[model samples]
Target: MPAVKPDLETADAVAKPILIRAGVALIFGLTTVFVQEPSTLWMKVAFALYLVFSGSAMWEYLRREPVPVAMRSPLSMAAAAWMLGTIVLLFLSAPQAIGLTVAAALAVGGVAELVAWFGHRRAFLPARDQLITGLAGLGSGVALALGSHLNPHGQLGIVGGGAIIIGTLLAVSGVGMALDVRKARNLEADRAPGRVD
Candidate 1:
């Protein structure tokens, strides 16, 4: 028997959550880069909220994959742990500590992606997505490390700038996806038996 394909509406509905996440990230990134000198309390609260939101999105993204339980479960757990550690370090107002924590988390996640790509090459779709994401994570880790060491006080701007760029990219991608979904829906409707286009 052939595999049943999902309808256009179903596909669009499934993608809605991811689109929302991308929008949220884009907004947060844009807003974060503008705060010249956030107070310790503000940093703690902001980081806490960011971790919760981003961590949930990451978990959901990974969980939606068709990878093995062992791999996905451990990755989900690592993502959660990374968020918790980063939140704690941010709350302590330790820039270097936070940077190191983020660096380590990114590095670990990146390596795991590479390993997963190699281990389950057939199961993984989107040819180079895993590799690209992994490399980007590693690169961001290095940048964060350098920023923390060179200018702890200026790290906020560095982080903010990075967030802005990332957020903008995500927002654009989300908008593109939304357009694609709309187009698919329209095409489907046009093909309906009684529809007059």
Candidate 2:
């Protein structure tokens, strides 16, 4: 019997929309700053919109998740919860609060990761990878958020929040983008010169 090849087609298709929305959301964020409609209420609305967008992006990722049926939902929910929880804390409190929130989130994520890691030992991504990524993103994002809210005034808060949001968005995107490019390179390396996916 022949081994079934993994469907790289589906993977690429899934990634496209996910990356597109994320990129668009970043641009929209920047646009909001330019429009000068970034009122405090408007900022909260932006945060809510971003949350919805993140949830959608996550749904796309989960479609390709290597976890089992029983585990996938829990992990997805956990990921969403942690992401939103971190964002909420950032908007509502100080950056230092992120430290405590991250500590708590990682603790919960650690347990779930440990369980999933043992259960899904065959996957390309170990559970701990997700755990670490979640924690690091939450921390940096909160720091950026806190930096934005400093002594709200005309020039400082305006530029500050803009820089912080854009900076964190780029930072978060960097890791995923690098991985995507690396994966494509590896694919190219494994195939003939004229071959492409």
Candidate 3:
């Protein structure tokens, strides 16, 4: 039997959250790229903003949407990690803290996303996008951890670059999901009774 296409409602539910994530990531990435040679204070502020904003977005979505039971924990875990990282940054001002905090947040979020992808591997969610994003976050986190001795600039670059790459991937995934919804609607219309081919 052929695979069934997801209904518009189901696809939209999944796509909206992914698009929100993509927006947050792209904005953070752009900020890092434009801010040249950021001072320790600037990096601290930027990182804090990124974590809180991203976490808030996820938190709001979870409260508003009836996410599947299997997926809810991982998403909530990621949001919690971001919030925790923000709190940690508020107390630590050292340059090294930036790398450590960013690494921890990414690793936690990455693991959560990977878990969600594994659980939903056969479902309607965009598993491929989730897999790639998880990998990117995990890989970047590992790299930052290993480069703990590097200057703040080096640490910022690694995390910022990862954000840009993941943001781009999610942007593409979001657009693809939106297009799929439109195409599915068109196909349904064509197949309806009394409709012209």
* Shift of residue 97 alpha carbon in model 2, Å: 12
Candidate 3 deviant stretches above 4 angstroms: 1-5, 60-66, 183-197
Best by lDDT: 3
Minimal lDDT window, size 10, model 2: 1-10
lDDT of each: 0.54, 0.46, 0.78
Could you tell which candidate, 1 or 2, scores higher by TM-score? 1
The true-structure Cα RMSD of candidate 1 reads 4.1
- For residues 7-99, write the lDDT of model 3, one tens digit per residue: 456556666767787788888888777877888888888788877877887776565443567787897898899899999998988887677
The TM-score values for the models, in the order shown, are 0.69, 0.46, 0.83
- Identify the candidate with maximal TM-score: 3
When 1 and 2 are scored with lDDT, the better candidate is 1
- Candidate 1 lDDT over 1-197, as tens digits, reads 12322333333443454455465556655556666667645554554554466567667656553435555654565466557755666546565666666556655655665665565556534213445544555565567677666334354454444445545544555455567668866776988899865
Q: Give the TM-score of candidate 3.
A: 0.83
lDDT of 3 at 157: 75
| Lowest-sum lDDT 10-residue window in model 1 | 1-10
Q: TM-score ranking from best to worst?
A: 3, 1, 2
